[model samples]
Target: MSDWKTLFHKDQFRFIDHTNSIEPVTALDAFAVDDALALSVEKGASPTTMRIWTHDQTVVLGIPDARLPFIKEGVSWLNQQGYQAVVRNSGGLAVVLDKGVMNITLLFADGNKIGIHEGYQMMVGFIQELFADYTDQIKAFEVKGSYCPGDYDLSIDGKKFAGISQRRVKNGVAVQIYLSIEADNQARAKLIESFYKLGLQGEKSKFAYPTVEPNTMEALATLLNKPLTIDFVKNRIREKLTDLTKELQQNDLTAIEKEMYQKRKQQMIVRNKKALGDLFHE
Candidate 1:
């Protein structure tokens, strides 16, 4: 495992907290924000950044998910369940995001220097450090039957509590992870299972969809058996970041980043429309 300090050691680090933004921000906007931040970091307009964000009921799908045989029906089903469906511009299968899920994005420059596995290891290492006080049992390995299953899935014992994915924009990389902080992890997994069932309808597709088993997933609070809140987790992230960097600065997007955000957001709107067709709506 690569030492997280290798990736995190910096003179200055920017921390952006969008977990409770004054204005409403959806998962779609969150993806765009990450893209903007990636561009800013690549351009040296910003330092290494750690962004904490959360979204309400939403199911973010990967490009291949949009190709499900009965995707239109699957998306409609998600909407009926009060969960908005949107296709993400990143790599991954369908993932459930809600108030209880906390997302962290580590954006940094010179992504070309890092291999895909290395990038993922950085996130795995950082997450392990974040909860080091709670448990040293966090393992990074694919949790079969979990949504968005990956080799870098963060888990305790055997149940998965988090999944990491990466998106590289030019020379910048945004390594993102969604942590099931405090929620019904099984419920979220079951939702994805049903979505796949409806989308596939037992039909075969070129892409292999996951066989989701609700029991294979869990939340961090449950795994740790602790009364963990999102705020509590956020404080831990701040403390760990402060200890890793010389200076920690909290601020909003810059003017250039705002401009890039609008452009990236428009691209996302177009992508979602193309994927969801008539089902797509603002």
Candidate 2:
């Protein structure tokens, strides 16, 4: 209800689903792509865009996370667990990425009209609408002891299943959410807990990292008692867009966006190198 109508009542909604990409789309690439789309919207080259993406077996770290005292050991441990590590181009601590997690980005050109909390609230409303049929009990609040905890973490009955973060480029804003569709949320939390344990080593850091508890998180399938799949959620997102907007169409990146994507992708690479040193540089 907090200005969500202004955020979502667009004449055109461009839908892009990258959930089935055959190529290895790392979390870094996903960030770059979102920035590209956001800039495209800002420049009036694209309409409001909704993108769905997924990555397999990756751990996305925040900039603060890269500065952890024992980061190399933590990254090595993630590698041993068959998870690739990369720092994201935004805020928040470490978060898990796997096949069962679906990431959604809603990009809109707001031209400084939207505040940061407004963007987060818009995503909260959109997600509640997305799953309104199942239950109207979704709540947005900081789920303490959960990975990437924030004031806008989305949860059901006190257990978090999703987290929202926002990034802005020029006049455009990208509101991103990661929904644990159907997988081992506790196992994912355990991995993050170990990562933090190795990275922090009980040091008193400037930033207060989360003390992840496996019980603080739950997958949507478990939370809703419904067999939810990424594919199913992807379709539902498309359907919801169609129902909410004047027009909804599956879209590919324009030439301008593609060019911007390449530049932003390079920027992401450089950022990762600076934050991660030789571990990210190829």
**Structure candidate 1, residue pairs in collision:** none
Q: Please report, as a residue range, the 10-residue window in candidate 2 with the lowest summed lDDT.
A: 1-10
Instruction: Evaluate model 1: give its TM-score.
Output: 0.98
Worst 10 residues of 1 by lDDT: 1-10
Estimate every model's Cα lDDT from 0 to 1: 0.92, 0.89
lDDT of 2 by residue, 8-94 (tens): 577777899889975226888889999999999998889888899999999989999999999999998999999989888767889
Candidate 2 residue spans exceeding 4 A from truth = none
* Residue 177 accuracy (lDDT) in model 1: 96
How well is each residue in 39-98 modelled by candidate 1, as lDDT tens digits?
A: 999999999999999998999999999999999899999999999988899899999999
TM-score against native, each model: 0.98, 0.97
Error of 1 at 182 (Å): 0.4
Winning model by lDDT = 1
